[model samples]
Target: MNILELAEQNFLITFSVVIGIGLLQGAIMGRGIRSRFPSLKRHARSASIVLLALFSINAIASVLKFAEPVKISVSELTIPETIEEIFTLIVNVMGINAGVGAAIAIFVSVTLIIFLKFANIHQIARYFIFVISCAVLIVVLLGKFTDFVPTAFQIMLYAFYQFGITVGIFLVTKRKETDVLSGIK
Candidate 1:
């Protein structure tokens, strides 16, 4: 109805689109992995790294822009102060910060995995490392969701930015044969 309301509406729709796209991407990627099965299994570590790298890039972006202004612009439309601030915080914090942290977690876990294998460590350490990775991944997702936007659309947009970090790195790093490429032979 009004200018601010309109801006909020647009913001909602934009993010919703992102989430929808994310679901679609996940489905397609999942199918690809499934079809490849055992062959794709070999690529797991690299794939995890890709997710981490993308998330980390986003986190870096978030850290860099944490104190920046609200960035809302569409065609000739502009957002009001209150709405802009909310979205701004969401992007800089939840979208970026959380993502970067997740990436680093992935890297650390992957490294440990490689070292243990190389040194001929037992199953105990490997299991612990796997648990740690799961913990990091869960924490990141929880933290991201906790920084909720006001509406359904906001959630979608934020999800888009959040998942963008995960998906981007995944696509980029996935070319490698191993997830933990650096430590291996």
Candidate 2:
């Protein structure tokens, strides 16, 4: 069978795997955040619930958007011959409007900045992440409103979004071990 057919047949499994990975990533990031900012340890359960709810909404919206058939015109079906062309094709398929794309870019930029500020990582690594995230935002904004930026940079922006969301999900989900032991006792 064709790849599309296989994907259609295993949609449920694919969705589950994606969500499972997101959850795992979120949990790890949350623990890291809590370790870095001990003030958040007191609100782990509530934070987890809020994050889970947000994730559920996002997943539902994604499923709803993709479950329907999409129509592609003949001109749009041309195969991309180069890496740059492939990236452009992917960006076009995402179909984000300029205004929405700009808003998302801004939001992602702010989120990444906040995450990097509080992330439990080495200073050098934090600086690298901060610089890369800002660069990705700039590239995404230019790509959205102008033609000078390469669409391949949009992939980096999306990756930042994924990381931000995962970290947000687990931001306060890690309580101190003593708290857990006290509850058990």
Candidate 3:
């Protein structure tokens, strides 16, 4: 196959990978939160459900966009205008659904973090907030600076951010040594 064909194959693979990893990460985070904060277990479950629904919708939109890519008319556009148009097109193609999903995810994550902070889990909340902030910052930077990056690569990067969140939550909710030892006995 030619390079274009190879890239297309890779793109589909990457999309699938992102979806799988995202689902797994969501499950992990939900379980961790529920275990760590029994009072907030329902909140964790609701967040996970909402996130999953949003992500699933976004994934479907992305696959549809990939299958039938959108075409634009740039003949009358100047350089700057063309750039803007292209950026808009890219955003549309790369799941405006995803943008909405990310926004909701961020809101839910921040709310959870706030609850954690108020509950006196200061250090864990700080780390989780930091990870979420970094993920958002990196995504914004990528959107601004990497116009040349492929859609598949951008999706993969999003998956990486989800993984980071999972890791942060894992650290936050892991059983203490004393708890582990007591359970062992």
User: What is the TM-score (0 to 1) of candidate 1?
Assistant: 0.27
Per-candidate TM-scores read: 0.27, 0.39, 0.37
Give per-residue CA lDDT, model 3, range 1-185, as digits (tens).
97546655787765565545554444344444544556543354455455455444444443333333333334533454577788866664343435554455545556655544454333543464457557655654454344433366455546554554454344333433212112211
Weakest 10 consecutive residues, lDDT, candidate 2?
176-185
Write down the RMSD of all candidates, one decimal each: 16.5, 11.6, 9.5
Q: Which candidate is the best by TM-score?
A: 2
Across 1-185, the per-residue lDDT of candidate 1 in tens digits comes to: 97536757687666565545544333333333323343544675666575465455544443333323233333424454698676865555434344545456445445434534554323543454456436535544544444422344433344464475356335534543533322222
Please provide the root mean square deviation of candidate 2 (C-alpha atoms, Å). 11.6
- Which should have the higher lDDT, number 1 or number 2? 2
Better of 2 and 3 by TM-score: 2
The CA lDDT of each predicted structure is 0.46, 0.48, 0.47
Candidate 1 residue runs with Cα over 4 Å from true position: 1-4, 10-14, 22-41, 59-159, 165-185
How do the candidates rank by TM-score, highest first?
2, 3, 1
Q: Tens digits of per-residue lDDT for model 2 on 24-117?
A: 4454445445556566667666766665555544434332222221333445568889999888776555543224433444454455357646
Query: What is the alpha-carbon lDDT for the whole of candidate 1?
Result: 0.46
> How accurate locally is residue 147 in candidate 1, as Cα lDDT from 0 to 100?
48
